[model samples]
Target chain A: EADIYQTPRYLVIGTGKKITLECSQTMGHDKMYWYQQDPGMELHLIHYSYGVNSTEKGDLSSESTVSRIRTEHFPLTLESARPSHTSQYLCASSEKTGIPSEAFFGQGTRLTVV
Target chain B: DQQVKQNSPSLSVQEGRISILNCDYTNSMFDYFLWYKKYPAEGPTFLISISSIKDKNEDGRFTVFLNKSAKHLSLHIVPSQPGDSAVYFCAANFQGGSEKLVFGKGTKLTVNP
Candidate 1:
C-alpha cells in the first residue's frame, strides 16, 4: 500500500477563511502533485513539486499555493476560500527513477467552501 | 484541447463478464500510460500501466492494450465483480525532464453482481 496520507477527509469552511490541506508520504519520492476535481469529473492538476524548494503550477489555474520544504510533505493553502473552491483535492507521488511511472495517490481531501 | 480523453462517462457490466474501458490521447509525447481506480470520496489508486515501447500490458484479471497508430488504449477486466465498481481514470506521462501525469475526464465502471 502507498504510504501517502491527507488530513481532514472532509472540511466545511466559510468564505474568505484561509485553510490548508495537509498531505504527507512516508515513501522517499522525489515528485509530488496536487489535483483538483469535482464529484464525478476529471482531475485537473493544480500544483506539483519536483523536490524540496521546487514547485510549479499545473495545467488548471488555481487560486491556491503549495510549498515543498520537505520531500514527504506537500501542503496546499487557500488564502481566501470561496464557494467556487468547493471540490476534492488529491495528492500523489511518484519515484523519479521512471521505472514505474504510475503515481501513488492519497485518500484525498473533500473541501466545502460555504 | 484536452490531451487525454475518456469519452465514455460510464460503463456497466454484469458479474463474471468482461468490462472494457477506453481512452484516447492527442499528445504523441506521452509515452507512459496508466489506469487508476477510485471510489466515491476517495482518491484514485494506481491500477496498471504500460509504456510506449510495448503495445500490451497485463496484470492479474486486468489487461491494457495500446494502439499507437490510433492514439487509443483500452482496459479490459475479466470476470468483473461488484467490488470492481469504481471510477476509472486514464493518465499519460511525458518522458522528459519534468515528468508529470496528464489525466482524462474518467469513466465510472459499474459491475453488477
Candidate 2:
C-alpha cells in the first residue's frame, strides 16, 4: 500500500549539531507538511511545500528549514540544533482537491538534543 | 494563543461504553474539521471529518458532530473497545487560499477491558 515514511524514528544529538530529518511518500502527493509536537502536546505546523521547489513557513516560527526537490521527498534541516528544538517531527501529505481532504502522516521522528 | 482547544487531556471509559471526545475552536472561518487517531510510535490516521455545513457525519462506529454555533465539535465512538485506546486530535482548516490546519492538543483515551 502507498504510505508516507520518515527516517530515524528516534534521534539524540548534541546541541549545536546540524541534523536533517528525512520524509518521503510513495503516494506522489503534491502537498507535504512538517509538524512539530512535544510529548502529549499540540502539533504545530512548521514548514510545508505546495510542490517541488515551492516551500513556505507555517503559522509557527521554526528555526528549521525544508526543501522539496522531488514531489515524493520533503526533508527538514536544522542549522544548529537546540534543546528547545527537541521534539517529534511528523511528515504528512495530502491532495488539494476537495474541501475536506484527509492527510496521511508518517510515523514521525523523535529528536532529543542534549 | 491556541486557536483549537481540547480541554480534556485524558479520558477513561469501560468497554462497550461510549467515548465522547470534545474539541473547541475560536476561528469561525474554519470550514472543515477532522479527527485523527494515533497510537504510540505511529502517526495519526484520519478517523472522520465533518464540514461546516454538515451537522453530523458517521462512519461505522465513529460519529462526528459539528456545532457551528458553539464553535465546537465532538467525536463519539460507541461500544468502545480496548483497541480504541489512543490519542485523538482535532484539526480545523479555514479553506481559503492556504488550507493549513489548526490543531488542538490531543486527548488520550483509555478503554478498559
Candidate 3:
C-alpha cells in the first residue's frame, strides 16, 4: 500500500493567517510533489522536489513554499493565506527510477480561508 | 494550451455494464500514461497505467489503451459497479516517469446499481 500521509485532512482559518500543510511518506521516494485542485478542475502542480534540498516550482504558479529537508518529509507553507487560496491541496510521491512508475498520493488537505 | 485533456466532464453507466473514459494529449513527449480514481474528500488512487511501447494494458476489470499516433488514450471498466462511481483523472508522465506528471481535468463517472 502507499505510505504517503498528509495532516489536517480539513482546515478552516481566517484570512491573513499563515498555514503549513504537512506531507510525509515512508516509501523512501526521491520525488515529492504538491498539487492544488479546485472543484471540477484539474490537479495543478504547484511545487515539487527531486530530493532533499531540491525544490522547484511546478507548471502552475503558487504562493505557497515547500521545503524538503528529509527524503521522507516535504511540507508546504502558505504565508498570509487568503480566500483565493481556499482549495484542496494534494501531496504525492513517486520513485525516481528511469522507468515508468505510478505516484502515490496522500489523503489531501482541504483548506478554507474565511 | 492544456497538454492533457479530458473532453467529457462526466459520464453515467449502469452496473454490470462497460464504462469508457477517453483522454487526449497534445504533447508527444509523454511516454507513460496512467488512470487515477478519486472519491469525495480524498486524494486520488492509482488505477492503471500504460507505457508508450504498448497499446494496451489490462488489470482485472480495468484496461488502459494508448494510441501514440493519435495522442489519445482511454480507460475501460468492465462490469461497472456502484463502488466505481468516482472521478477519473488521466495523467501522463514526461520521458517515462523521469519528469513530473501532467493531469487532465478529470471525468466524473457515476455508476448506478
Reference contacts preserved by each model: 0.65, 0.74, 0.74
Per-residue lDDT of candidate 2, residues B5-90 (tens digit): 99999999999999999999998898999999999878889899898989999999999999999999999999899999999999
lDDT of 2 by residue, A42-102 (tens): 8899998889999999988999999999999999999999999988999999986755577
lDDT of each: 0.93, 0.92, 0.95
Q: CA shift at B39, candidate 3, in angstroms?
A: 0.3
Judged by lDDT relative to the true structure, which candidate is superior, 1 or 2? Answer: 1
Steric collisions counted per model: 0, 0, 0
State which candidate has the highest DockQ.
3
- Report how far residue A51 has shifted in candidate 1, in Å: 0.7
The DockQ-derived docking category for candidate 3 is high
Off by over 4 Å in 2: none
Query: What TM-score does chain A reach in every model?
Result: 0.97, 0.95, 0.98
By descending lDDT, how would the candidates be arranged?
Answer: 3, 1, 2
Off by over 4 Å in 3: B96-98
Per-candidate Cα RMSD to the true structure, in Å, reads 1.1, 1.1, 1.1
Where is model 1 more than 4 Å wrong at Cα? A98-100
Clash pairs (backbone) in predicted model 3: none
Order of candidate numbers by TM-score, starting with the best: 3, 1, 2
Per-residue accuracy of model 1 over A5-113 as CA lDDT, tens digit each: 9998999999999999999999999999999999767898899998999999998999999999999999999999999999999999989885547789999999999
Native-to-model Cα distance after best TM-score fit, residue B98 in candidate 2, in Å:
1.2
What is the Å distance of residue A45 in model 2 from its true position? 0.3
